[model samples]
Target: MCYSSNGQFLTQIPTWLIVVAGWFVVHHLSQKRDQRKEARERVDQLVTAILSIEERAVRFHQSDSYQGDVARSLLFDIQRIIAKLKRHPFGSFVISPTLLKELRRAVTLKNFDASKFTRQEANSAILSNIADAVDDIEDQLEQEYERIYLSTEWFVVPSQQKNCR
Candidate 1:
């Protein structure tokens, strides 16, 4: 009777342990998946903002009125991005110091040499720097996306599947 009771207790312990462990694993996986989804959505929005900033910078560079409403609009976009980052919990998808500095310099150059730079030179210099900053940020975001989504993939077919199909 004692041996039987001990065996029953051992079985119950494994059953309870399995239930708890399974719950923990599922909860952890769910949290990770949710975090990835949030990050992906945030990055997508950030990419759109970066593209808009690049477009606005190009237009500002080409236009005669860098101090006018158009320039203000471009500056507003940058400020908007900064504001968004302030409230974000997981941090920015990607915003490098170099990119930030280049963006600031481009804006400053546009303001200082607005009347000096020909449209073409402004396009080549200020607009090009804006585009480069956008590209760098996007590259960083892409790396993050790949790290999260592409870390694992099947290397070979299973034996049964290989045999059958």
Candidate 2:
């Protein structure tokens, strides 16, 4: 009778342990999933900010009324985004050095005096140069996004791989 009770108690202990362990594993995975979701949302916000900057730049360039304040504001917004990304937890891993360089080049318009130029000057080389820089930045951002978020290789764990020996 004593042996039977001990056997039952031992079995119950392992069953309880397995249940607790499974709960912990699930909890850990849920936390990791939530963190990834948050990171993706943050990246999306940064991408949106960059797109807004690009649109405003193109609009300001094409407009007849060139307000220096508006131009400066856009420049400030770009700089702010860059600074924020640099300070982000995943910024160093996700944002390539090339993207940062391109962003810096784009903001070189601090001394841009669009008011001095005639309407014909709107289509000048400076405008094209800014457009090119914006294009390059966009390309770099896409590559980084793909590498960090879209690629399955990035999320794969060696231990979890089916082919692992």
Candidate 3:
């Protein structure tokens, strides 16, 4: 209860109650903002990893020395990344089963023995598959990123609309 000037009665909320309510609202908003930031960071890390794979694939494809060890190492790195992405909480949401299947298919170098195939065949086939897989992953990531970050829109409340009109 509150009394204004001239002892007029005024309905007043307790200051402590108002403060608590404000705190809750602020805390909720802060949590949501933090979640969004973390999600964006995860997306960025995934994108970086994919880009690194692409760069490495391109370099290996162009290099004249088509070492089996290097190819095996690259494949292992890609598989490891894919496994990590699959295990990641955010990654599981963003990466689909179909995409994972496609990645696995692309990463598998069929009959790829460095000694058996000429340099050109190895480069064009195996490296190209890796490149294609990376491209697909990047495209999917971009779509997910846009859906999460760019598609949200705020709408005006009814009272605010009335005021605007």
Candidate 4:
């Protein structure tokens, strides 16, 4: 214990203890901020991937001629999304395991034939699945904005939101 000139009693806490505690707090906050930044970046990557897949899917589905190239690219984007979902911070809010499985199966089965769908039904089904996945991700991110803790953060996504409907 120590007494100040004003006759006030000083705490026995050590200077090193205060410094260590401050360092811990700063380190913890810095880590948290870095995590949030990473999560935001992952979301951006996911949206880019989803839009790329949608574009390729639409192009192939609309094309009447063989589109092996487009099909391959689309499959690649789907696989990218599948991988992205594994690290996407919003996984807790979105049910992605089933989506991932279905996307993988779709890629496996159609990687060779997606560009030239023989049946209109197949195109519709594939398109529906892709659209649903997009919508679900968008919804989850939108909901993320409403989170009490994340309110102070910000992000930017492609302008696809206006055209999704």
Which one is best on lDDT? 1
Q: Pick the candidate with the highest TM-score.
A: 1
List, residue by residue over 1-165, the lDDT tens digit for candidate 1. Answer: 255567787878888999999999798667756766776788788889878887777766776544566666776777777667555532523446666667656665554455564554553766677777778767866775555443453222222222321
Q: In model 1, what lDDT does residue 146 have?
A: 55
Q: Where is model 1 more than 4 Å wrong at Cα?
A: 1-9, 64-67, 86-94, 111-118, 121-123, 144-165
* Candidate 2 C-alpha lDDT tens digits along 1-165: 355576787878888999999999898667656756776777677778877876676666666776678777887887787787765434534555666666546544433476463332556655666667666666665665445545465445322432332
Error of 4 at 5 (Å): 13
lDDT of 3: 0.61
Please provide, for model 4 over 57-145, each residue's C-alpha lDDT reduced to its tens digit, 9 standing for 90 to 100.
Answer: 65666566657777677667776666656554654434446656665554345534644455334447666765676666666665653
TM-score pick, better of 3 and 4? 3
Q: Looking at model 2, which ten-residue stretch has the lowest summed lDDT?
A: 156-165
The TM-scores of all predictions, comma-separated, are: 0.70, 0.70, 0.65, 0.58
- Candidate 2 lands at a TM-score of 0.70
Better of 1 and 2 by lDDT: 1
Candidate 4 error regions (>4 Å)? 1-16, 87-95, 102-128, 140-165
Query: After aligning candidate 4 to the native by TM-score, how far in Å is the CA of 91 from where it should be?
Result: 8.3
Report how far residue 11 has shifted in candidate 4, in Å. 4.8
**Number of backbone collisions per candidate, in order?**
0, 0, 0, 0
